[model samples]
Target: MTLTKSLLLGTSGALLAVAGAQAADLPSRKAAPVEYVRVCDAYGAGFYWIPGTDTCLKIGGRVRIDTWYTPAKSAVQLRSTGGPAYTGVPGGGTASSTYTSANGIDQLGWYARGLLMMDARTQSGWGTVQTVVTLRLAAQTGLAQAGQLSSVPLAVAGTTGATIEAAYIRFAGFTAGQAASNFTFLPSNQYHSIWSPSFPSGIRQFAYTATFGGGISATVALENMGDLAAATTANSLGFNPYSATAATATAVAPQRLPALVGNVRIDQPWGAAMVSAVVLQNNANFATPGIQAVTNGLGPLVRKTGWAVSAGLRINLPMLATGDSIQAWVSYGVGALNYTAIPNLNANTATTANYTGGFLRGDRDMTIYCVGVGCASYGVEQAAALNIAGVFTHYWTPSLRSNLVGSYIRLTPGSTTRNTDWTNGGLSSATGWSVQTNLIWSPVRNFDIGIELSYARLQQSLTGLNGAAPTAVPCTAAAPMCNASISPSNWTGRMRVERTF
Candidate 1:
């Protein structure tokens, strides 16, 4: 009996030891604590705190599709023997009696774009610190691709590319980096529309805004003036002459100082108003390896400065109709023609034919000339211009709205021998106008589709040398030959679809 009891006890002890060993070898089940994202309401909607950090961030983006049609893109000229025959000027141009092969024209085009944006903000002892970044990717076809100023043949019928639209930081009432200029006041339309007059789009700058304790405020900024240099240079006949006898012109010197800009604004429930101004410096230097060494002595060209002033008003008319408003602005510039939206002769025209008869044939802002056989000396002359624009928006329904937009520009070159040369070279002072009506429908939140119909006209003075001769056909039944002045009109249609989040 003693031997049996001991054996039983030993067997139980062995079983217990085996179970304890198995338990020690088995895996354990335990989870680490999770750090979940938290909503940040201190800012605005769509903001949340980054896990394990105090910084708050918001991510948003947009996708857009566009289609456009313009007569300027489609009109072509037909030529016959004995001068030129009057071909239909669908876009606008003198009917040249000179015949050549048929030229290709662009009548319709499409564009697709995607945009991404990031906004980050944090509260600090000084003030709210904020940063915004936006990137855009785009693809275009048809006329949109044909008009690009590219040196190399486009890899495809259209182009695909990316661009940094805006990247800026705001802290303590100071803004630094690339962003919209304060000179732009009450802009109410997307940049894709031609009815909107030219406004300083974007530039790298450092600016400070002071709040006057009411809805009123003031801003002063120092913006890069390099873009204006490009505008001035494009107009020079011999600025960067590729061949001899291109006219003795000078090149715009590199910018040495930043443009100065100032603005004063008032905002209230009834509406908003603003007055803005800018001072720009213009500098030029004699052409290097001078086109006419004997004509133009080697020396720096004349230096001049330009100025622009603008005033705008926006009035809310909710009593007339819900969400109705009117915005109007006028601008005047001297030596700063770009502010008038007519700097580059063909900057806005889409078709080559319309470009040929563009409002101004020579430089828009300034001109240079040389005297003597080879152009002995050079002088500078500045241009003056004015721009007027207005827009009215009316809400037809909760999801539908309509906008009427119009703009007009007048440009006059300085009275100088260079101006006369440009006149003989087929350039003259001109006026241009554009009008558009647009309708937009939004069926759901963050998504909208819109369509716009626009008309544009350009009338150029007859003071310049005769352009391409007109066909033998009489200008009218009462007279023979084409009219002295050239006036071209265009019809454009645009459609857009966009989604944002």
Candidate 2:
């Protein structure tokens, strides 16, 4: 008993000594436990360790629908369907390909869009990387109705497909894959004007963006030029069947749609402003491939290159509230029409024999400018054209808008003469103007109703060509006669409703 008690006391003394030593080492008070969580790259920045796995995801997209209507007296055919110069035509037949105006019946119509979007991302020490995807659904192919002529299909009635709109991988300061063309600048739009030429002007290309100090940024890319010329060439060579068939055979070139573009902006207390430029190759002739053989199958087939530059500004106007703003934009293009295809000079004629449409030459340019003011607008657009040529947009309310565009085109008329009539057929007065206006009301967030109207006029000075009534003014040289069928003017009208989700 004496030995056990002595040992126990010794052990107790050692424990007491150790406890006192630890208490001295500990902080003055009890400390709280720190928690740690994991984050993935997809979430974008600021990530902590997750319990398991190593990834992140993000999802976003907008669903929109458009509808419209117009007076029956208008020249535009609401139910018309066709492509390019041969637009307005309702049916697609080899014979109707040459008609400037459509031959379909007038009817009210509607189209809608359903879009789904998602993005997956991952993080690294350097930066974040993300893959984006978008799917579009519609009752009918909007491209066909919108006059978009791309080989790629964009819409389906009940299916899912990758959007030609924008599908790419982005990381650091670079973007690659099918992306928007780097030439457009006007961002505010409230009208559904027929003059909306660049509605979906983006192109699939590889691009890069770099941000400098301040609010300045730059972008560049390479595109496929829609391969219009190449397609024409292949069609002429029988490799493709999409080229315009004509009398003169021109070898369309494989236009390199490479575009170099950039923008610089300065953000001041007053507002933000930016300037941009883009250079891309376009087909010179819209008729057929570049013509080479005329009398003998020989000589050189030439193709042309085109480009455009633009400037835009958005002013918050300190005098106005944050919701109120003003915007301005302008774009100009030189040698923009690379419609290198030879015209089918003999299409409208009786015989099936093909003939050259014409050769485009000299400076071909286009210009667009607009000013807008609005807030609380349904579409969040700035300006709206009121149905005038060269006016990009005019919107008085959230659901009403309009636009009209005018153009002048000069080409090398075959045989120093014209071919078509009042429709601006031959080179005579290729100058044409079209007015498009739409009155729309979005009763709900994803639904809309609207009406559209348009009028177009073309003028030409005949040089020479076949005419039953020959006069001192050249004849039978390739120019069109002053016939009602060839007169240079047309009109269109449409009514429709749409829904989106």
The local distance difference test score of each candidate is: 0.60, 0.37
Task: Residues 161-276, candidate 2: write the lDDT tens digits.
Answer: 33445577888867776554455444413323222123242445677777777777777766555522222331111111122232222234335456455666666666667676
Q: Pairing residues by index, what is the TM-score of model 2? A: 0.54
lDDT of 2: 0.37
Worst 10 residues of 2 by lDDT: 347-356
Candidate 2: stretches off by over 4 Å: 1-55, 61-63, 70-103, 141-163, 188-201, 227-253, 266-271, 282-301, 317-322, 337-425, 429-501
Candidate of highest lDDT: 1
Per-residue lDDT value at 116 in model 1? 96
TM-score of each: 0.77, 0.54
What's the true lDDT of residue 229 in model 2? 25
* Root-mean-square deviation of every model: 7.8, 14.4
